[model samples]
Target: MNLALLHDSDFIDHDRVRLTGRRFAHLAGILKVELGDQIPVGQVNGDIGVGRLERLDNDSAELRVTLDTPPPAPLALSLVLAMPRPKMFRRVLQTVSALGVKDIWVINAYKVEKSFWQTPWLADEALSENLSLGLEQARDTLMPQVHLRKRFKPFVEDELPALLQARPGIVAHPGTSTPCPSHINRPATLCIGPEGGFTAYEVDKLVAAGCQAVHLGSRILRVETAVPVLIGRLYDSCAN
Candidate 1:
């Protein structure tokens, strides 16, 4: 973890926090921190700053913290993605968060297996843990929101149009004629499909819902790879 993410529960007082569990293990074991040392810390959805270690033991540690700097600006992008395989979903979630995608929609596609949604990683606790790992990696504190829509048609017909009203929508398909736009650096919602890509009927629905179909050249990238590439391509926020 690059920055120790602080939760409200971690605080004992306005300026003090107690660390335990994975965080304590990392600091006490991996970082091998000494008393009086300072470490980077950020409060969730709050500011970034440093914590000075005042006490330490095998089970826990205490830090006096000061938060002044705000976290990095979030990307002006909304990601609409087909649910990925269980094995890959965790990594994809972290990557999306690290890139500063604050809005995410995980919808079902024709190729997406129903079993994918049954994964424990979708549990609330697991989602928070993975997102926290991503935030810590990026030294960011803002948590990304994940919206799950199991039925594709209803989501496209009902909710997508409203989301598109504020941000233009783009669907990434493998053979589409239009290349994915680069450096738009504006608010947009991007849809990506499962491993085999969205079926013709599914693509039509998304297109009808006001999404422009675009491609990332001839190469087909896995959802995990495409997410970061697409975000980097579309947002100077990520690059900067």
Candidate 2:
């Protein structure tokens, strides 16, 4: 992890922050942080800053923290993804977080297995742990908010309109008249499908909901690869 993140509860005393549990072992062993060393630090949902290691023991380490700037602005896009298999789900979460997406919706698809939803990783704490690892790796403090939708039609037909008010919407499909734009300046809500991709009926629903169908290219990409590539293209477009 590039930045050591702490929760408000983790603080032990003024000018001294204690690391216990997994974080302690991560610092002492994985990171090999030394006393008097200044390490990157941030409070969860707060500012990014530097922490000076003041003391260390077998159980914990203390740090003197200096709060600095707030975390970077979140990506300008929100994602609506069809939930993948459990194994792919973990990677997708991390990938999106690393790319700085702070809003995500994982919805059920026709192709989605019921068993996939039963995975322990769907639990709030487990999801948070995976997302936190991504944020920590990226040196970011803000955690993405993730939501799950079990019904496709109700979500697209009812809730999507309100969500689109803040941004333009696009749905990635395998074949579309318009290719995915290289860049986009405004905030966007991007919907991507499962491995088999969205059914024509599903794509039509999203289109009717104000999402324009677009394609990455002729080539089909797995959910994991498509997410970051699309995000990067959007980011680059905005930059130009």
Candidate 3:
């Protein structure tokens, strides 16, 4: 863990706080933190801070936290992705968060297997754990918000407009008139389809809803590869 993440409950009544659970093990074993060492720390939705290691025991460690600055602003893009297989899901979540994406919508698609929706990783606790790992790796304090859409049509036709407000929207398809733009400064909502890609009908619906169809390249990419590639390119473009 690059950053030590804490919850409100993790703080003691006093300024002292104890690190237990997974975090304690990580610091002790993985990071091998020593007393007087200052570690990057943050609350789930709170400020970024430094934790001065004051004490350590077999099961827990105590620290003095000095919260100072807020975390940097989140990425300007939100991702709409068709749910991938369970094994790929964890990596995708981590990659997106590490890239600073703060909002995600995982939706059903024609090529998506129905059993994918049954994955236990979709549960809140599991999802949070995966996302937290990414945040810690990136030294980011804020957790991304995740939304699941079981029905595709209503989400695209009805709910997507509000999210699209003030943001450019693109639907990633294999073949389209326009290639996906390299870097975008303004906030954008990007939709990526399933393995075989979105059905023509789905594409039509999305296009009608004000989403422009764009392609990454002629060759198809797995969701995991495509997501980070697209996000990184967009981030670089925005930065330049």
Candidate 4:
């Protein structure tokens, strides 16, 4: 973990926090920190700063926290993705969070297996777990919001129109003639399809809703890989 993420409950006082469980282990076992070591820390959905280790024991540790810096700026983009396979979903969640994407829409598509929705990783606790890992990895504190849409037509015809007002939607399709726009550096809604990709009919519906389909190149990429590539391409903040 790049940052020790402290939840609100971890705070014993305004400037002190009690660490236990994974965080405590990270301090006691991994870092092997002592009484005076200062570590990078952040409050969830709050601020990024440092925590000075004060007390250490097998059960827990206490740190003096002083938060003065804000978290990284969030990407001005909304990711609308067809729900990925369960294994890929967890990685995708982390990747999205690490990239500073604050909005996520997981929609249904023709090729998406019904069983994919049954994964426990989509549960509240699991969602928070992966998102936390992502945030800590990036040393970012702002959490991304995940929206689940089980149906395609309703989401496209009803909800998508309203979302389009914020920015023009860009749909990633493998065979699209137009190359994906690079360094867009503006608010945008990105629509990614399923493993086998959205059917032609679904693509048309997204287009009708004001999304322009674009392509990365001749090669196709897995959801986990494509997400970062696409985000890096679209946002200057991600470009190295």
Candidate 5:
């Protein structure tokens, strides 16, 4: 973990935090940090800073923290994704969060397996853990919000229009004539489909909901590969 992400529960007082579980193990075993050492730390949805280790033991560790630096700027992009395979879901979640995508919509698509939604990774606790991993990797503190929509048509017809009102939308399709625009550097909503791509009717619905259909050349990419590539194409950089 590049940054130790602090949750409210980690705090014993305004300035002190107690670390345990995976975090403690990492510090104790992997990092092998000594007492009095300062480590990078950030509070969830709060500021970035440092924590000076004041106490340590096999069971836990204590640190006095000071938060002042701001986290990296969040991407001005919203991701609307068709549910991906269970095996790839966790990685995708972490990838998006690390890339600073604050808004996410996981909607159903024709090619998406119904079984994909049954994955434990979609559970609230699992979601938080994966997102935290992403934040820790990016050294960011702001938590990204993941929205699940089981019904594709309803979401597109009802909710998506409103989301697109503020950030104009784009949909990534493999063979579309319009190539995905590069470095738009503005707030945008991007819709990506399932493994085999969205069926024509579903693409039509999304297009009707204000998403311009675009493509990433002739390459057919897996959902996991496509997500980061598309985001990189749309924005100047995640740190921006």
Candidate 6:
């Protein structure tokens, strides 16, 4: 973890926070930090700064914090994704969060297995934990929002249009004529289907809802592999 991300619950007072569980283990066992040593820290969705270790032991550690730095700039993008396989889903969540995608839609697609939704990784706590890990990896504090839409029709028809109003949308299809646009400065809502790609009918619905169908050249990428490449293609380098 590049930054020790503290939640509101971690604070004992305005300036002090107590770290425990995974965070404590990381500092005590891996980092081997000493009192008066300063470590990078940030309050979730708040500020980035440093925490000077005021007290420490095996059980827990306390630090006095001063937050002044701003969090990294968020991506000017939203993601509409098909739920991935259970094992890959966790990594995808972390990847997107680290890339600064603040808005996400986990939707159903024709090729997506029903069992994919049954994964424990989609549980509230698990989602939060993985997202936290991603934020820490990026040294960012702003939490990304994940929305689950099990029924594809209603979401693509009823809800997606509104989101597309602010951010013009696109869906990644393997054989589409249009190449996925590069370094798009405007905020966008991007859609990616399951491993086999979205069926013709599904693509039509998204198109009707304002998403342009596009492709990433000749390669057919797995959901996990495609995400970062698409994100990088769509946005400029993130500012530190």
Provide the global lDDT of candidate 2 against the true structure: 0.87
The prediction achieving the highest lDDT against the true structure is 1
lDDT of 4 by residue, 98-195 (tens): 99998999999999999999999999899998999899999999989999999999999999988889687999999989999998899999999999
Please write out the lDDT profile of model 5 over residues 1-240, one tens digit for every residue. 999999999999999999999999999999999989999999999999999999998789999999999999999988999999987989999999999999999999889989888999999999999999999999999999999999999999999998899677999998889988888899999999999999999999999999999999987899999999999888888525
Q: Candidate 1 residues 86-155, lDDT tens each?
A: 8799999999999999999999998999899899999999999999999999999999999999999999
Worst 10 residues of 1 by lDDT: 231-240
**lDDT value, residue 185 of candidate 5:** 94
Which candidate gets the maximum TM-score versus the true structure?
A: 1
Evaluate all candidate structures by whole-model CA lDDT and list the values in order.
Answer: 0.94, 0.87, 0.89, 0.93, 0.93, 0.93
- Which ranges of candidate 6 are over 4 A from the true structure? 238-240
Task: Report the C-alpha lDDT of model 2 over 83-193, residue by residue, as the tens digit.
Answer: 998999999898788678899999988888888889999999889888988888888889999989999999998888977996789999988999888667568999999
Error of 4 at 217 (Å): 0.7
lDDT of 1: 0.94
Q: Provide the RMSD of all predictions against the true structure, rounded to 1 decimal.
A: 0.8, 1.8, 1.6, 0.9, 1.1, 1.3
Query: Considering only N, C-alpha and C atoms within 3 Å, which residue pairs clash in candidate 5?
Result: none
Candidate 6 local lDDT, 1-240, one digit each (tens): 999999999999999999999999999999999999999999999999999999997789999999999999888888999999988899999999999999999999989999999999999999999999999999999999999999999999999998899677989999989999988867999999988999999999999999999999998999999998888888886422
Clashes of each: 0, 1, 1, 0, 0, 0
Reference-based lDDT, residue 224, model 2: 87
What tens-digit string does per-residue lDDT give for candidate 3 at 42-123? 8887888899999999999999998887986788888999999998999999988877899999999999999999999999
The candidate, 3 or 4, that scores higher on TM-score is 4
Worst lDDT window (10 residues) for model 5? 231-240
